[model samples]
Target: MTARTPARTPRRTLRLPSWLPVDGYVLALLGTVGLAALLPASGAAAHVAEGAATGAVAFLFFLYGARLSTREALDGLRHWRLHLTVLGSTFLLFPLLGLAARGLVPTVLTPQLYSGFLFLCLVPSTIQSSIAFTSIARGNVPAAICAGSFSSLAGIVLTPLLAALLLGNSAGGLSADALLRIVLQLLVPFLAGQFLRRWVGGFLARHKKVLGYVDRGSILLVVYTAFSQGMVAGIRHLVTPARLGLLLAVEAVLLAAMLTLTWYGSRRLGFDRADRIAIQFAGSKKSLAAGLPMASVLFGPQASLAVLPLMLFHQMQLMVCAVLAKRRAHDGADTAETGGAPSVGRITPMTAPR
Candidate 1:
């Protein structure tokens, strides 16, 4: 018999470490910032870019209002306790810690960086990451979904108001006219979307993927506009490597505190493991997507500096939570193994961000 040719094994491509969950969108954001640093818009071009960013922000809110299911939000009200716990952690506890961080002002953090750090605390929890992490940990998926949606919806009105109350004049003039502009830019479009949802809901559902691109593109436009304005103002020189390092350290502590609080506090409140997982993921994180547009509206030209801490925190949370989610999943499997049950299945792959 003729000798059979040996079968060749396929070579595997190199991959990133599984522990690191680097998001592509975050990379896109970094690229946008770099582009702005290199080639910022000027004068008339700046005005045109600003106007487009405003329109894009409005369109983004409109999409949010359209896509969120009214009935589901209403149904979610039944889990009022869990929602309340999450809201308290996000709005109340976070701000308190931010206020306490004032001691670092002009020492560890510059005034501008501190302001951004405080602004980071005031922003709402993320919708996509909260639900995504909760599901990965085999937690209450529906509660996670509802909690994140509620936080996003609440943030439209709450974030600006909180910034007005907390950040005051430092947010680059949160005046009556600014408030009116915000209402027109963010609230009005959202309400309009809700009103027209009956007619456009099906279209939106059909074009879900397209709308997601719109979402990311709009945020990119906002980023470009804000950072371009900053470049024009020459604010980039304000942040040194030392200050950035300090800011990262402060944010790491803040993230750890919130994570511990959410996990332990939920247990103290008599929640089950599933609900605690949902609460921990939902309550402990801030929404960079929601914060960027709002900062552009509320802080105007100063938004670039104001959103810097938020951008950093977003990346940090994602990496930390990715590791946490996997650990939680593995623990569950271990418990099943000891109980004489079959090995638990792996976590479901996360859906792409909405």
Candidate 2:
């Protein structure tokens, strides 16, 4: 038999692909952002819409609580390395970038967009999407699940605190009141779900698809409300194509810097290749779904522009990471094919459910 090494992807391809491609959800997100850029809304109607949007944001967090599995939490215990990597990336590396980017204000990116750019770095990683991609790529599904979950849990506190510390003066004078609001709006609901986890758990598993729609819809509503506020606030007048191009370049650098840091940092910390991949992918991605709603709450109408850099970076990460993930998979295949070692990713665990 010809000696063929197994394939392992670069630590990069560990995240989902749609994040990189012009997929449906991303396109939908861009459409909403573009709509806001073109037609900003105002008046008492805007106020009412904002109120509704705020309520939806709280409810979305509540549902997040209710949907997460108690059973899975137990399984997550086994993947500590993967989970820690994701959390560090989300809470530690992401915030540092947000802080560093602040020095660029009025030079490359406008002050307002720069604040938004910083806030983008403050949000959590995506859960469903990350896990979904990891599973599809035949990476460690359990580790992906746990890692994504841990990042979200940490973000409930970290994202708000980081924003307060890093983007305070820039985020329209963020108040302690906003911190309390985040706790009440996001943390409380999530805790409640944990409290009621046993009862709500089954309900969510059964209605996962329906709940997914609820989650996406809630985000869309948040976008509409925030865009309406931006319209009322005239944020559109401040952003220009040149400034946006500059923002993209800066964000590109930031994403690349982060990807390099997290991937190598974890390896230096002695994580295996699987874990290193998870860290690089999960750490590098900023959640538009999580950030958009939080940005609305934290930055109010100005959130429309603030989240723009994040939105763009979110897509950029998706594209770059998709290619990387595939390359990693192929690398694994080649490694097994060449080395004659049975590829770990392709081997089904005897314990796995049939």
- Which candidate has the top score in lDDT? 1
Relative to the true structure, candidate 2 reaches a TM of: 0.86
Q: Top model by TM-score, which number?
A: 1
Least well predicted 10-residue stretch by lDDT in candidate 2 = 345-354
List, residue by residue over 1-354, the lDDT tens digit for candidate 1: 999999999999987787787888989999999999999998999999999999999998898788888889999999999999999998999999999999998989998888899999999899899989888887888999999988888888887888888888877456779889889999999998888899999999999888788899999999999999999999779988988999999999999999999999999999988899899999999998899999999889998999999999999999899888878777767877788334435667573242
Off by over 4 Å in 2: 1-20, 37-39, 136-138, 172-176, 345-354
* lDDT of every model, 2 decimals: 0.89, 0.74
Q: Judge candidate 2 against the unseen true structure and give its global Cα lDDT, from 0 to 1.
A: 0.74
lDDT of 1: 0.89
Query: Candidate 1 — which residues are off by over 4 angstroms?
Result: 1-12, 172-174, 339-346, 351-354
